[model samples]
Target: MQKRVKYFLIRLHYLTVNSNHERLHQDREIIYGKRGLRQYWEITTDKETISDDSTWLVMTKIPKINYKKVGKIYQIRAWVEYGFKQSKSELCWADFRVTNYAQIEKWWQLVMSAYLMVSLHSDSFNPMVTPVSEKFQQHDWWNERKGWKNILNNLRLIIKPYLSFNIISRWLKVFPIPQLSLGLPRLINLMNEFDCLRYFVYFWDNFYYSSA
Candidate 1:
């Protein structure tokens, strides 16, 4: 049935649907049945060339009058899928083991923010040239034009050393300490050794008092 419809449309030579420079010939038909069944538009694109063997089909609740927008929506959907794929695979978005809904939501927010940060940072560099120093040239992952995943991985390696106990301790001195004897390293080490509940309590205490 589908092949017959496609052949009929091809014979008719339907008007071209312009979607981002790709000229697609589209034909839409409305299918109607019982009152309980909702109406839908069955849209099919004619094959572009003899080499292209398949016809693209889209079924939508949207009216036939808005068929041009459907092509654009599909183009945008591809980009959205690409972003999700990169986030999950490259950014390790599926690595979390949390059972709480709130915790999972927060993790997704952080992962998206991190992904956006890497994307923005990569865009700042010239695509034709390497953004790193000569020292990074010897590394296997280093390239003339680094993708978002490579940029993010390299950024993690570059920032890891600066997040050490010594660096964090120095930075924490700016905050007014309640106990001078309780150094940042000792306090941080204690927090590291704490169980999940203790850590949660400590975090909430700091958060509540900090806001006050």
Candidate 2:
């Protein structure tokens, strides 16, 4: 029975991975582009509204940033504050003040829902849903199909603790992951290749923000 259970667990893991593998890759490409040249933005709130109190941005370069899509910038900021880490390089934390954690929590839910949808449907997991499919039809997490709903529910169960830990950790000043040590050449390369880096970074940001 134990062997059978283990086998079942293994198979279940693969099934989950196979089901969404392709979609992940596609999702990465969709938001980040081929080379990942997308810019990132962060926002923070002070008194009440989301404002320029404390904002940290991880970008390929400042010059390549597009200010047209300001909404996306806020979304990215929410993702970071919620505990998502950079996929590639370390980003300097910009100081910003939020009025309260309550407002950030609300934004987190919306972003989380969007992130799950794209993750399940992107090309990395052999994403096989159609536009007509019920899953692709909406961004609401509760409205997702049974399988996806299960996944999202499980994720939420996991995420809440993670978020709480993150907030506490940041406040207490702990490093969950070690900071990177790159020399001047690599730093210059990061800035010089901002176009590609921005795309990749922004793509990840979109995925991360969608979780809220």
Candidate 3:
């Protein structure tokens, strides 16, 4: 007693608008798939040539939807696919080997958290770690790192110090408290170990960049 509304993409060879009807930019026309599946379409074509790959042959069963809506919906599909791609390839969405549901959930949460961090930021905030300014963008490293991959790497360096307590503790071994062993040492050596506070303040740019 009920049905689902959907769109089916069919090649142009098996479908064309009714010849008796005067052609318009967008017309509700009959469509026939290669396998003979029939549906109505909001037909649109290129401004110059209607044939070849210029035709966007999207068919749908939705009532009251226009050609513009169809075009926009398909355009949005591309971005959705791109997000999934970044989630998989870039964020290692499937890289975790957790056996239990809770472990898998946390792993995916961490993965998506990273993906969300990068995705939510705008290109205006380029290099990511630092706010984008005309003077800042003029650096030599900035020229080579005008891409998202470099932005992610820069973000890691910016946050590394705050996350390095465990690693720093391993290096120092023990003073009972992690802060006393790791944090106090770094704070004490801030000036002596690295020359000046200028290098400590802008450690990523001056110290890390120089070392790299």
Task: Tell me the TM-score of each prediction against the true structure.
Answer: 0.42, 0.20, 0.42
lDDT of candidates 1 onward, in order: 0.50, 0.36, 0.50
Clashing pairs in 3: none
Error of 3 at 187 (Å): 7.1
Best by TM-score: 3
Decoy 2 TM-score against native: 0.20
Q: Where does candidate 2 stray beyond 4 Å?
A: 1-53, 61-64, 79-149, 152-212
Instruction: Report the candidate with higher lDDT, 2 versus 3.
Output: 3
RMSD of 2: 26.0
Error of 2 at 186 (Å): 54
Task: Give one digit per residue, the lDDT tens place, for model 1 in 40-109.
Answer: 3334454344233334454555544354565556545447888669666776777778999999888877
Tell me how far candidate 3 lies from the true structure as C-alpha RMSD in angstroms. Answer: 13.5
Model 1 residue runs over 4 Å out of place are 1-65, 76-83, 124-143, 163-212
Error of 3 at 68 (Å): 3.8
Instruction: Give the higher-TM-score candidate: 2 or 3.
Output: 3
